[model samples]
Target: MEDNFSNALLLMGVGLTTVFAVLFLIIGFGNLLIKAVNKYAPEEEKPKLQAADNKAVASIDPAVEQAIDLAVQQLTGGKGRAVKIQRL
Candidate 1:
């Protein structure tokens, strides 16, 4: 009976130690992974003028100016006014 009790105690001690060791390893590795990701993450780049589309506004129709002004006034509760259109 004494030998059985000693054996049970030894096994319980080993199991508890293993559980703590595994938890420590998981926490340590998680911290290392976060640090590595922050070190190598890509930075946000500013938009370049050369990369912008030059013809984005080229398809605007001159006939839609009045309609656009009315829509804008309706949308903005009459606070918006239409500016005079100038032909380039």
Candidate 2:
């Protein structure tokens, strides 16, 4: 009975150690991959807002703007307003 208990404890220890080792290895590899990608990947350029976009937003129909304002007011419990509506 004593021998069996010792064997069980040993098996448990070994299993736990193996599981933790594998998890640590996976975490290390993931971190390394993230660092490598960030180093090698080109930074994306953001699109600049053009003057035409502002003109379009200013030219939006009053009815459509009212609808947008109503939707925003309802969605935000009448605490928010639609300041600018733009098209892509």
Candidate 3:
């Protein structure tokens, strides 16, 4: 009975140690791969959107702006107000 108990404890210890060792190795390898990729494969620059000089920028209405401000204040229980209103 004593021998059986000792064997079971040894097996359990070995299994837990193996599991932790595998997790540690996986994390180490993942970090190494990430560093390699970041060093060799830097991000490319994306093109910025350009608007023509002649294109007219849309203006926001004062009445709509006031309404938005009022709604935001009410939504926040009179604690907040919209700082800027822009027409999409």
Candidate 4:
């Protein structure tokens, strides 16, 4: 019984060590990959927004404008605003 218990404890220690070692290796490799990508590839710049394009909004009916604003608000969950509405 004593020998079996010792063997079990040894196996448990080895298994735990192996698991931690693999976890550390995975984290190290992941960090290395992220650093390599950031060093080699950078993000592109976004296009700048032009001036206000609200000329077409003035000709739209009041009810239509209200409906469009309501739709935009609903779709964006109240986080977005309808800045410019143009007829295509």
Candidate 5:
């Protein structure tokens, strides 16, 4: 009975030590990964300058715009006007 108790105590001590060591390693590795990410993360706001697209859809021409305005008046029960597509 004494031998069994000693063995159980030794096993418990070993298990606790192993758990602590693994926890410490995981925390250390996580800290290192976080530091590495912080060092190289994209913190700069580089503005994406879009090139001006002058291309207009051939189907949605000025004549279609006028038709759209008429359609909007009919669809929304005369509540709103169709959006004007002014060509720049």
Candidate 6:
């Protein structure tokens, strides 16, 4: 009976230790990967022509716009409004 109790305690300690070790490794490796990527390949700004083109608005069908507005109002309990909608 004493041996069984000791064996159970040993297994529990080993299991908890293994779980914590794996978690620490995952967190450390993920942070290291993010840092390496950001250092080597930082974001670049869009070209001036593309940036200017983005400011121009295209025409939208009135019926489609109304449907989108109604959907947003119903979904958000009349609190949220659609700022932009794009087709995927």
Query: Residue 82 of candidate 5: its Cα lDDT?
Result: 55
Q: All models: lDDT? A: 0.66, 0.77, 0.70, 0.74, 0.70, 0.69
TM-score of 5: 0.45
lDDT of 6: 0.69
Candidate 2, residue 12: CA error in Å? Answer: 1.2
TM-score of 4: 0.50
Q: Which candidate is the best by TM-score?
A: 2
- Model 2 lDDT tens row, 16-64: 9999999999999999988998889754442332335777776777788
Question: Model 5 clash pairs?
Answer: none
lDDT of residue 63 for candidate 5? 70
**Cα shift from native, residue 15, model 2 (Å):** 1.1
Q: Which candidate is the best by lDDT?
A: 2
TM-score for predicted model 2 compared with the true structure: 0.50
Regions of candidate 3 where Cα sits further than 4 Å from its true position: 1-3, 52-88
TM-score for all models, in order of appearance:
0.45, 0.50, 0.49, 0.50, 0.45, 0.49
If both were scored by lDDT, which would come out higher, candidate 4 or candidate 5? 4
Ordered from best to worst lDDT, the candidate numbers read 2, 4, 3, 5, 6, 1
For residue 14, model 3's alpha carbon misses the true position, in angstroms, by 0.9
Tell me the tens digit of each residue's lDDT in model 1 across 1-88: 9999999999999999999999999999999988988788643342222313335323445457557766877999866655543334
Task: Write candidate 3's Cα lDDT for 1-88 as tens digits.
Answer: 9999999999999999999999999999999999998999765442222223323213545577577777987999876767655444
Residue 22 CA displacement from its true place in model 5, Å: 0.5
Q: What is the lDDT of candidate 2?
A: 0.77
lDDT of 5 by residue, 1-88 (tens): 9999999999999999999999999999999989998898744442332224435434356577667766877899866565544346
